[model samples]
Target chain A: MARAQELAMRDYVQEVSALTMRWVHRLRREKFSMLFTLVQPMLFWLIFFGSLFQRAANSEVMQAPNYMSFLAAGVVVMTVLNNGLSGGVDLLFDKENGFLERLLATPIHRSSVIISRFIFVMTITSLQILVILTVAYFFGVHPATGLLGIAVVLLIGMLFGIGLTALSMAMAFTVKSHGDFFSVLGFLSLPLIFLSSALVPLSAMPTWMSMLARFNPMTWTIDAVRPLILSGWSQALPRIGMVVMLLLVFDALCLYGSTRAFRRAIG
Target chain B: MGRTVAIETLKLAKAFGDVKAIEHLSFQVWEGEIFGLLGPNGAGKSTTLRILLTLLRPTAGHATVFGHDVVQEPDRVRRLIGYVPQERAIDRFLTGREHLLLLGSLYHLPKDETLRRIREILKLVDLEDRADHLAKTYSGGMKRKLDLACGLLPNPKVLFLDEPTLGLDVQSRLRIWDYIRRLKERGITVVMTTNYLDEADHLCDRLAIIDGGRIMALGSPAELKAGLGGDVVSLTVGAADMDRVESLAKSLKAVPSIRAISTKPSGIDIRVESPEKALPAILDAANQQACRLEFIEYHRPRLEDVFIAQTGHAIREEFPSGE
Candidate 1:
């Protein structure tokens, strides 16, 4: 029984860690792509939000005390969503090239595989978000909130990253091909980014679009994280709670779907 | 026999939809034996190996490596054996040393031990000089050698190679055969598959020929060939007067020791206990019938003849050469 347990530990720690390390190695080798994660959001923050905030550097139309400050928080959340969506493409490649089949042959803890992917994507996404936030601070988006708000920013970004990454991985399994996966990205991600108050105040959008934004996962992520970084850091629980609830639901669905896909692929 | 059977499969079976890949397949490889899973394409050779390695669940039945159940106790089985797939599974972006070190870690080798084993494996496969190069930049033979090195990193009790030299050039194939032989000499149990009869004949201590998800023949190379006859007298007859050639060869059936007469598209290939004794009678009968003989060749019976004896077609004809 002791030997059996030892073997099980090997499967969990060694096997799963190696699989995840591959993802880290892949990201490090293609370090150029991280530029897009940073530059893409920076471009939107400059053009769209820059024009809207030019008239009033500090006002209610910006929804916070400062417009650039409000928009910077939104930029960080969008960065997380982008990384999560692209990581799904990696899963599609595994399916197409039969690498997943090779991975299955080894005796490894199944959940470790997914959990490792979550950790890797979340790490890089948070780093890129930090870079964006630092740039915004240089441009005069000062935060009235304290250290607690900084922790909230990091926590919300990680939870959002894991949730969307799980959903994308689930898509990699259900979708017929890599092309199908990227097409879903094209159709779903951009609109979700735009619909949320990631670039503008929710009140600015028409009533119908505002209702959709309220339902959108991206909206919760931005709302939960923005207050912490901008000024209203005290009223944090409800928005953070909403983001947490949505993240848990998405994680459950994605983990369930990927496990099923794993079995099916092995068959 | 050194300790126990290194690998065993009992009534193992797998099916994909309506097509069976393996059916009630059973075999045993002793602790240090070089066992070959020889078969033509689609004969379920790789399927059987996959089952033994615990990669795919058997539709029915069970297999074990080093006395550990492959299905019920796969982690135990994985600890005892290494596997080299037909396609290279190494990360092309990683250096050869990195691939081996990572696999060694997965196998739970201590860090220092993992590095030591990586160096040793690279030396064994003669890949030490290319250890730092990315695997993608290596040629086919070099990549294959690195793959074998990865398999050996953990010092496994048994190794499974699925068509290790399938598409390799002649020199590379021979190099693989030599490495496999060296492994066997060190008392590592090996289970390998190949569609090439010569590969089995040259490298395997014992072989099993499978077809249509069943083992058609099994034995050592000499033993399988000896079962057919002492030699074969293969003759090519002109396309003209085919009936006359058949009738004339039939008339010589009175010859004392022609064990079997096999026919090929180009000629009648006959297996005889003694080629010299039967050749005169066969030739004289052809002369009497006025049938022209285009070619005649005689040699000791080969494993191809054994395959012919069992399956009514040469192995090459059954599994076509080239692709």
Candidate 2:
């Protein structure tokens, strides 16, 4: 029984990895789009948003030494949020074009496809976060916890991202067309971003809004990530643990929803 | 009598809200034969394929592929079959080779074995020369061939093709037909759906004509055509006095049966038996009715005649409009 279980687990891993490589190949082929999806938004935030807050760097309203440092974790988490929410577009295209049907017809474990998608989205988002952090480093903003803090930030982003990617995929399966998908994305993305601590810390928001932001996963992610960039391991680790627990619960719920959505769509 | 059944669906039915996509669709495909599900668009051919391939659950009844129940043991059924859908499923960004390799990997083919089979499949589909080109650069037929290559990558026991040649030109259609034949030669049981009567006649060893979510007729193409019996004499007449002309043609002695008479904007098609003996009488009747004859032809019974005989409607007339 143990041997059989081990073999099955090995097969599952192999299949998931193979499926993930398909997305990797596709990303490699559409190098321009991949680059644009990552670089363009980060650049917009860094230059446009960064310059707006530059004059208020050391102001009492700002919590960090500089606007760039204050905004770095926020931008990283925002990039992750953007990428994670839009990751399901690939699955939507596949479903629209009948590729999903072909994939589903194969004998491989069905969940591997979803797992591979999460891996793909997280991998791309991680790279984008790294690029943003590197640029911020050059601009005299550095993580207080240094390399270790950056790793923790990525972990927090990925944990938060898994649930978002899964939820996006569920929406992809639920909706009828790409138009409906984009409309929903357009309606939801800005609200989710603005309501969180992405552009501004939760403290800067109105009292009622701050209370709501406390319940937002993005807020939790940013709260956990911010101290690593501005303050150090002692300040970051406890929040990181809390956010990780929240993400675990979020991921479970989203995975359950998306799997049900997938089954319904295919059926 | 002991031939193995590759696939069997027993009283299978699927419904979407008020619409029944497939109703009581029961059929058996013997091992190593090319079977066709013949129907026009929206006739539930695709829905039936989806059920058999375990992509969709049937609302009632059961289907099995190689004795494994589709719903109960979908993974087992999936392992035994591959599906090439009507729409081109190839990623436009990937090369033909890359597509095959990806599919092979999904099938859990080993690295070396996958490479070997990719080469073999590329050759089998005659896509070796252009295998490295991105699929977006491929022509319609090339892309279809690539789709076929992906389906064949796993060496599945049964291959399901839904309208394998729906929109291809004549030459491309013939190429797909030949590839399907090769699949049969390799002893793969093929279940395909096509709206084209000639494609059904030329390729299917046995076929079931489905329309309005039910099987209207089922038999080998020759058997279905033979069921109609006798030849078909078609007379194209101007729209004037069509009802009178039809009644007159029905009165003729040589016309044992007025198989079908269809009215179009330009003309009316009248089918009768024994054209050689019936032509003069038909013409005489047309003249007496003051219906100007536009065209006339005689041909052996075809699958279209069988479809018409079974449903009292032309197969071509049922093609989904605006598609």
Candidate 3:
């Protein structure tokens, strides 16, 4: 029995790895797109938004050394959110071109296909986060928890990103076209990003808005990651633990929804 | 008939809401033979292939691949078959070699074994020289060949080619036909669906003719053609007298059977037995009725005539726009 289980696990790993490599090869071929995804967020946080709020750092309303330091964590998490939500475009194109049907006709476990999408999104999101951090460091913004905090921030981004990526995949299977997908993305992205503490801290927001941000998973992630970049481990560890638990629950729900949608679409 | 059954469907049915895609679809594909499902557009051929490939669930009844139930054991069914759908499924960014390697891994082949098979398939499909280039740069025919190469990577027991030559120039179509023949030589069972009668007649060892979700006829191409009798006699009458010409031809005793008498824009087509003998009688009858004979011709029966004889409508008429 144990031998059979081991063999099954090995097969699952092999299938996921193979499917994930398909997306990896695509990323390598479309280097311009990768460069754009990475650069767009840095351009916003470092150059545009950083200078916009540079003078606010000395005011009581902003409680950090510089706005860039405060906004750096937000930008990292935003990159994760943006990449995760748009990840389903690949699946959409696959469906339109009949590649998804070909993949479903194979003997590989169905969930492995979805898992590969998450792996691809998370991999790209990790690289984007690393680049953003490196750029922020040169501009005099450093993590209080140092290398360990950077690792924690990556974990937080991954946990949060997985749920969004799974949700996007579910939408990909359910929607009829890329137009519908773009509409849904346009409808949800700005609201989710703005409602969270990515741009402004919850304490600086209206009481009702702050309360609503508390329920947003993105808010939980940004709150955990912000202290790691702005303060030290003493202020960030508890919130980091809470965000991990919250993200686990979110991923479970999103994965369940996506798997169900996938089955229906393939059937 | 002595061969083992590779795929069997018993009263299989599928429906999309109120639209019945396939109903009571029952047929047996012999092992190591090239079997075809021939029909025009919207004739349930694709739906049947989808069910057999375990890509769709049957609305009623059952289908089995190598004795494994399609719905109950889809993974097992999938393991035994490789499907190349009508629509092209090539990713533009991935090179031909990468596509094969990716599918090979999905099939659970060992890394070294997959590489070996990829090399072999690239050669088999005559794509070795360009296998490392991005598929986006390949022509339509080359893309199709690459798709076929990917399907062959697993070396499945049964290969399903759904309209494998649907949209291709003559040379590419013939190349695919050669690949299907080679697949048969290796003892792999092939189940293909095509609306092209010539393709079905030349490539399939036996075929089932489907129309509107039902099988109208089933047999080898020769058997089906032979069933329509000996020869076809076509008469082109003046456009105004086409109906009179059809009625006159039907009145002849020498032309025992009127396989199909369809009105063309210019004249009428009349298929009958022993056209050499029937031709004179047909012309005499037309002359007796003073029906103008613009043209007349006689030829051996073909699969298209067989389809018209069985279904009472030409395959082209079924899909006028040529889907």
Task: Judging by DockQ against the true structure, name the best candidate.
Answer: 3
Candidate 1 per-residue C-alpha lDDT over B1-323 given as tens digits, one digit per residue, 9 for 90 to 100: 24578887888899999989989788888887789988788889988988887778899987888778988887778778887878876676778887786676677677899888887788889999999888888999998898788778768889889899977998999899899999988889999999888888888988888888988888889999988767888888888866665676687677787877756666687778777788898898778888888889998887777876777566666455532
**lDDT at residue A243 of model 3 (Cα atoms):** 87
Better of 1 and 3 by lDDT: 3
TM-score of predicted structure 1, chain A: 0.88
| DockQ head-to-head 2 vs 3, winner | 3
Local distance difference test values of all predictions, in order: 0.78, 0.86, 0.87
Model 3 lDDT per residue over B95-155, tens place: 9999898898889989999999988888899999999999999998999999898788888
Q: Which residue ranges in model 2 land beyond 4 Å of their true spot?
A: B236-247, B253-296, B318-323
By DockQ, the candidates rank as 3, 2, 1
Clashing pairs in 1: none
Span of 10 residues, lowest total lDDT, candidate 3 chain A: A56-65
- Model 1 misplaced regions, further than 4 Å: A1-19, A34-70, A91-107, A144-147, A173-177, A206-208, B1-3, B239-243, B252-256, B312-323
Sort by TM-score, top down from the best: 3, 2, 1
Compose the digit string of candidate 2's lDDT tens values, residues A122-241. Answer: 988888889899988888888899898888888888988889999999999999999999898888878777888877777788998888878888888998999999988898889988
